[model samples]
Target: MSAVTFVSNPIHEGWTLTHTGGDAPSVVERATVPAQVPGSVPLDLDRAGLLADGPREDGTAADWMAWCEWRYATEFAATPATPGERVDVVFDGLDTVAAVRLNDIEIARTKNMHRSYRFDVRELVQGGANTLTVDFVSALAYARGIDADARHGDVSRAYRGVRKMAWGFGPFGGPPAHTAGIWGGVRIERWRVARLDEVRPLVTLDGDSGRVQVHVRVERASGEPLTVYATVAGAEASAQIPPGEVTGVVTVEAPHVEAWWPHGHGPARLYDLVVDLHSTDERLDTHVRRIGFRSAVLTGAVNVADAGVESPETPQVSPRTEQVSVTVNGRPLDLRVERWMPLDTVLARIAAEDVRARVEEQRDAGVGVLHVDGVGVYESPAFYETCDELGMFVVQDPPFVGDGYRAGAPVQGEAIEETREHVARLAPHPSLLTYGTVEDRAYGSLVSGIIAVLDHDRLTT
Candidate 1:
């Protein structure tokens, strides 16, 4: 793997944010930090003292949500494009939409904030000083042409899906919310041999032992020999890596392990697993994952027509159509809890301590389970970790709203991959009870199949 330069939080690099309202970026100014690459207009406006403090004269509060335009520009010293090495600019996340340019060349365009974007800047960037600019447009206007019907059954879901100003809403608006500007960070991933693309950790629990199936994916930048190394709970395993894109699995085991339990039952125990891409003895890239020893299942009965109950006059199977039960670690659990979601509109703004505080509050108040609408929404790693520590189970999913009403197979496929990613992120936590079913129960079976295809072990409702 090549050298990776993390330009996370561009604010620290003395970058300037210009509200480029016209055709080109006008010389503008704002504070920039290293971890602040995920800068947005609402956040910027609020910080700049431009956003309305309360309801406006027109009875609208968040006018800046659709009114502001942001141009984030930064200069960094970079190694010139090497003849053998490749340089790629990767933005882990952006807002609703953006146009990225390196030097003066247009390198990439962003549409959906949910997906990540990578642009090859091997030719555009040179050694020495470099100029990188991300022009973020108005998300409200850009979302106008968004095919809501093709994605979510309603445009509201599409609009609400994007990270905008939704939390702490009142009157016309309280805080301006728009999925604009760099929401994640701009990363310069430089590598010559290979780069670790993904690490999918599959963990399972048995009678007296806990196991982890580590699946590692690598992207071959050069046809150089490589091996993958994984270390979990002091146990280690290694495998040879092939060219192009390839996946390899390593098994790690711990005998006579104690199971994880929620709240009153017991403590949530977590183990760390570290994976590395290596060349002979040299470590290329490394990532650490957490795993837990516990399993959850949702078992119950579903009422069918019973062959004789189906008639033209009484077409419906009716209210007693299904009975769902919950169990944790093979033991039946009497579940009675209210679902929870943070009140904050801009979740990214919430600090880790704040998240932990909320989770603690919920657990202290006797919330047995946190029905996380979907794994995609309310996506805070701290949120999951806190639940794990507090022993509060989370019923997670892919996307919450407009589930069974999704438009096509592409959506379902996307959902499956996201579920895999989501499960992998939260796999180490013990507070997760079960993956929940889609809200739109009409095509519930199809959605369930999508989730099952990826997360095969966990129970789904």
Candidate 2:
């Protein structure tokens, strides 16, 4: 990577190019710390990084691609005056869609507007000032054209699929035809991560024995043989994890286990789990997770044909498909009532605090399961982590609304990749249960393929 410079204009410093702008005007500030790198340069409302723009006349899909490239190039900052530390570039909204690149290296991307994307930039960034750019693009023309087509309205999936576009929404209205720019924040930060990259410590009861299944994933760059150890509810176990992507399973049986209860009953007792990754005898990373020992399973489908709504003929599936709930410690609890609201509003205004508060509120209300409708945006990693912490179960579905039902080779590939990413992010969470089927459409073998990506070890319906 070449040396990057912060400038008012889109200037070239060595091999790095820098530019910045936002939904509003801002000042030209120096990139004094890592957190200010993304939106470090001052930006305007021009359609530079936008994939497509317009008053709607001659905009094409090609325009959208160009706009996406530009949005990826734009710069953003977490704070103008950032402390020197482990910086995290967090993307609340990249408009309808975008991929974030740091110093010419691709870091993250999101197709749904309702999700928050974050990238760890500690390694990519160095001491002193650095150049950060945000390339935001628009989805106006594609969104509008898809909405207006006669054929687009023919199927249930068509209307449902458009929900993920996340362009036409909010107080400021939708993206302009062909207009694409960074509509969200480019924040850099002094962030924190537990020593482990991935930690999965599960507690379960089988027959008369209580077990804790432990799995840990260390950071690849650590470049050291890790000593994996865990202490759950005061019980400890240790194992040696040699270097190069280690995957080891250690099971601990608790002879006297106290079960976790459902909402409105007894309080859920969370056991303290300490996972440490060590090099030789020195600890390289340590993560602490409050884990609760619980067992849950979806009982049955309620109102599969028609939710509460009544119709004349045999009503097939509507929005309310399953009566989803979880059973904990022999008690059944109805999950939270939620609809798949499009990612438009939330994605338009990306804020970590806002996302955290929303999830916390849901948990406080005793909501354990969130049935996410496919007609809206996908949840972000930050959102999922909050769910994991709050013990919220997520039922995920790939975008499959309208005539655009993805199947066969192309869609299956996409779904497999999506499953890999989703499972990698949320598999450790005890709250996460089922990986739902596609909405309103089904591809015979595709279901098996998707399950194989993540839950291959278990048998399912």
Candidate 3:
């Protein structure tokens, strides 16, 4: 048994709930205390922790619910037989907005509640006397506007019926559980370091010959030159790269190199491409990435009816007729789709346990693409990394939509900067396929102009 603890607050729907199996209700009932503790501040005073004018503690006030604030810390033993070299601290989520301080150093934050968030603090901490502090601010009360109650009575009833019709449970089915708290799994993990910051293996086929480009980026801290090696289809090649830049191009002549096909016809022969970056006699990092020597382009026209698989009854509509789809080389593929809403302030107030379950469910469903919509704010990088390895494509839009009165003028430069920050953080993923223009027509033009000026390698319009 290791010396760590599990602490969480999960609010499902309007109810405060716990995720610890059959013991959750009992645990919450025993943990409620009104007295404030030292170093733990109340998010709101005067009202005595009540949020949105909910029911009072005595249950006399109508619609009473505790303001989503809790100053609590608990510990759990570390799991035995861990997999990595160092322990990594991961926070699955903390509502819509959270400030996480590990041993007094602020480490993470989240703006969207729709996705689970995480942080790996292996380098930030060491053994003995580790302190973790997380402040989760709720967005639930505001999210009430988007909840079903805001709709017409009959429509809301129909929505509930549809949910029961489909999944046997409506959206509003509970007491407020842990709304704004550490709601997901928090753990210390271990993993080995990669020699290179990034490794991209590019394979291109033309008639009879295949071209391979081993593009790599090694960190300056890893002070060493690397001999990069690759093995594919019983063919082998090596190239020497200096410490700073490790870009190399190699050619292979394989008349029978099997090509991959999309969704139909012959099998998608995925050849194993292993890249090893070695320093003199020592192996530094071994990175593996799938390289499809094929071409994929948008096929359909940009029209509403052609939009891929969106629910027809949704209030939102895609303006373009051509819903985005990919065809590898000449074959069309029917890829699964997953949509992402921004982790807004309202969502941050919700429980992280609910968020984690949703993420796992989507992953379990074999969602192939994640369309991060523009309405919500940017999500944590954990979501992106999951999509990258899970074989999911990501279509990211700048987190701005609608035409406010202040359009053409420079209104919120910070918002644009925030969007740019999100793009920079997640753009390196191989799964990221497209960048949607901001909602405003003029803003789209501005974003395109900015990308053209900054990133000249790819075409963006």
Candidate 4:
């Protein structure tokens, strides 16, 4: 595209955190200490020797921390934006409700910890060192403020209103530990021409041929002619985008494609799928991900199908019956399932090697499927990549458990966007067999509807 230029600077240092009594502005700082992005308030407190060693029987310290607001501040140097250029601060994840400010001016506000956010800062960023701050409100307080009718079978009222992990609120027999902070990486990106917003690759098989469709979306600076290119499994495809159009898809087909299989059944075959955005000869942005070719279906006791039974004396009647079985590549699979739990309550403390090791352990134990519970936060991308490599199937549940959450417009809207983002991230993995249905007292229908609309190819139970 029009002489594209893109540079990303990760802000990984010089972060300091402070706690305040509430969400309101506080001039008095309490216990300022060095902080880490992709970290949580509890983690920083422990590192600073401000928290107790182990879980307290009384939960006095934990309760106090959960009600206090925390703020993370940092400073970074950047050159001012030039003509036709854009600068934005991107957060991969933010724990719960928070407000982002640049140079003392509010730039953006975020509520969902599972969703990524980007705020254009070209106008606010300075040529020299500029202050960037994220102020997080008390997650427990915010959740408790939401007004919703509590129904029967509700697990935790504190977690029902907020889009957070339920396990931290003493659900699933876990200790109560309400976590908050920047739980993912933060970076400043400067670009011109256009940037890739999202890229999704979907694989399907037709007899001996495998088809891959890569859907791409871009944020453009102006109406310009662009092309989307995708290559996978030695096959390439390109699509010309109409001027001003922001979305396009490229399809590639490979004959006699090898299907990916679970461990002990067959070899797991994976291919690199690369998508590039181009304007004329220059490449604007590229997205790369590993994908495998395979089809998984859930049957028996889970998926109810209508069957017609004919009697000698009566006409045919349709009756729904449970078909409880799982199949890969049209063959029945004997599932050895294991529940995958988070290694730590502070998500950022879990490293990539830890995830790989845990999944490897499951694979060694002959676990074919990992039942990722819905009560916890979404695992990092490394978790799924490990499953894809080890040939382990994953049955992911939405972030809704046995709770009666408010189905207000705001709650429904957040849940919809969260499900969409998660499905897009997890759909390309051949190991992901099904997106489990949320069978809670509330939000079950909403979650199922979102999954059905976003990923109809995968089975839902």
Candidate 5:
């Protein structure tokens, strides 16, 4: 345990919804409501009987999809803290595009729904009340503009599904609509000196001894003395944490350790791993993770490119698909595959229980591997937690797939940034065994490349 204090407040209230009135609007009539994130305004209004069943026919919410914005405002009170402590406003998900301001000053701009965002707001935190507001824009507008003015032979499909409003979506599961809003809770966390930015633990066992490889990233006071410890099975390893940025691989050797196994293999035993960080003056941060010692090895491969340099009379054969499989603890799994569509078009409204129940439904069907499709935004936390607890393998396909890049297309700098955030956020999960991209060659390369650099433990497909 450590002394770091975090103050969290979910921004579930104090919000206003308005539409840029036009022909074919989802918010047919203007209305205001609390920011019941993870849900859309229409969904909330319908629940409250404020709006009639949304647009009974096609393209009814044209303006709604292409326009419409949600605004949230609240006054924040800074906590009693020491001089060196830092404060941050965190967002787990922002539907498509957002501009956030604190005390009337813009602080962050977010575009990817798959990424978690945070703004170091120490400079903006005031001794008195601080006003923070977030304005969300309809990305569909930008997408529509691009679609109309698209140059010939653009990369693959050029646009992504999540980028614009499409043919299928509404009360019924037709085409998909944007679930605009803060699709996740808005909260605040404050810390001092050192903060445990990230902790990724990989465990393996040999005979009765266990070997732990913990990747720890920390932010501490520059040039200050810091120490870190990894403890398990009554054994521990402590070392000096390098000043400024202390992020490195810390290996711990444990005796009489237990190994975790997947379903039907054996008991899925787990141990509580506690990594504590301390400065010269006081305890700074503690990160606790549920870890199991096991080996996940991906086997089999296929040739991605045809290197057949044949003469006029010669012929060649190319293997363009993957004949891949996985093994755990040296035991090959005859995997039962399970595929899920976008859990919800309105992602934030999805209840934790709902996601868990869905995963359980498949796990009960003996799903050894859950193919997290690369079609939509990343699945929710509940979805991943259930899979982790049940030992279900995740083939994480970052939310991207369409036509591949084309000849003379614009550089996909934004798409690359989105891929960066999605990969970094999902990298710590032990259940994520592979980084699988959709078949679009150009887009897939950009997406897979980020995963290649950021993740070494997981296999790339």
Candidate 6:
């Protein structure tokens, strides 16, 4: 039997950008310039010598760019697909809002910059060259159209209605540049037989033993019986999944496992957990996750008066403050946290090495924890991976900041989904200790409920 095949083609070059001045999307015949994928409009415009040099005190350049619409176009040749093969256009991230088209046919519409998107383009892709266009609408215009009641009270109100980061919206930190573009990589994936949809590993330690429970989900073209194999720390486990079932679980236990520790305490030991999908003797897909065995808990004292549980008869009782503490591996850890903000105003300009360097600076300063502030965008995966290796703890806050804003159904739904994706992506990292949102009391119950349910292993404040 032949093994299933999977291939990825990255669309990185041959991109051209066009900028239009109006609020609506239209074609502009002037100043078309070469562009780069995984880049922003400001970066491209500056490269083409179209953008003004230096920051303006009046913020005219930033405001002008934020109000205009930008489009990026690229072309690539599609390869012929074999029988039972599936082709998809995968966007790792899109800044703010965008409409993606393949050969002039709209394939996907995205609004959130923090989430990834994928569109099935098997029918749209031809064997020859095809044109791909991503037309980005003005984020400022979109935010202005939202209802007044759905926004906060400050300048950040313009950014609250949309899922974009609030760092650039002034009054907050960073530049006043409201960025837009394909800030993440775009690629085409072709696969046969089956593909891994999600791979989540929950790591736990009991005394000297460590247990890893891997939950696997797959999408298959046929109703074939598949098996999932998980290997970690010299131990292996396999599960025979029945046909028509999309999910399976495998557990691997390691005896005499070393525990992972935070900085200043002990060595941060890490192990690779590899998972493979198999149909009989042939492998279909594989995934690898780096995990560490440790236990982190957040304990605190709650005040009855502050929690609104005080009665009139208890008027003599004073409102007590909550004293919070963190314990890791059955030892109390002193948290010396520093805010991890954006390294640059433009997201695409922040490289992996830059992230590593920033993290190293914090680690060298005797900082044990890096607090990912709520006002900033989600740090790239490289940030978490670096923290995991360097033995620094991370406490993350969701991107909501300032006075809590009321969100309509669409915005609220997207926020919930984005939270789910973020939790799933960051769960494997040992350095991730807890999640706390800014203005938690003002957010609606639905978002808080979703986070609590999805991240039951970690503390949510």
The alpha-carbon deviation from the true structure for residue 194 of candidate 2, after best TM-score superposition, in angstroms, is 14
Per-residue alpha-carbon lDDT of candidate 2 for residues 305-378, written as tens digits (9 for 90 to 100): 55543333322223565445455556666554444343333233345677778766766866665655554445
Local distance difference test, each candidate: 0.60, 0.47, 0.44, 0.77, 0.60, 0.76
Q: What is the C-alpha RMSD of each candidate to the true structure, in Å?
A: 6.6, 9.9, 11.9, 5.5, 5.9, 5.1
Select the stronger candidate by TM-score from 2 and 5.
5
Report the C-alpha lDDT of model 4 over 264-339, residue by residue, as the tens digit: 8898999898888887667888888999998776653222233422123211111121223567788886665666
Collision pairs in model 4: 1-279, 299-323, 299-324, 299-325, 300-323, 300-324, 301-322, 301-323, 301-324
Worst 10 residues of 2 by lDDT: 1-10
Tens digits of per-residue lDDT, candidate 5, 235-264, equal 788777766657866789988776666666
Q: How far is candidate 6 from the true structure (C-alpha RMSD, Å)?
A: 5.1
In candidate 4, stretches whose alpha carbon ends up further than 4 angstroms from where it belongs are: 1-4, 22-29, 52-61, 147-155, 301-324, 440-442
Index of the highest-lDDT prediction: 4
lDDT of 3 by residue, 8-60 (tens): 23212221222211122232323433321111112212124433344333222
| TM-score, model 5 to reference | 0.81
Winner by TM-score between candidate 4 and candidate 1:
4
Instruction: Please identify model 2 stretches exceeding 4 Å from their true place.
Output: 1-127, 139-197, 207-210, 222-224, 243-245, 304-318, 322-327, 331-344, 348-369, 378-394, 398-417, 440-461
Which stretches of model 6 miss by more than 4 angstroms?
1-4, 23-29, 54-61, 149-155, 300-324, 403-406, 438-444
Candidate 3 local lDDT, residue 154: 21
Name the candidate, 1 or 3, with the larger lDDT value: 1
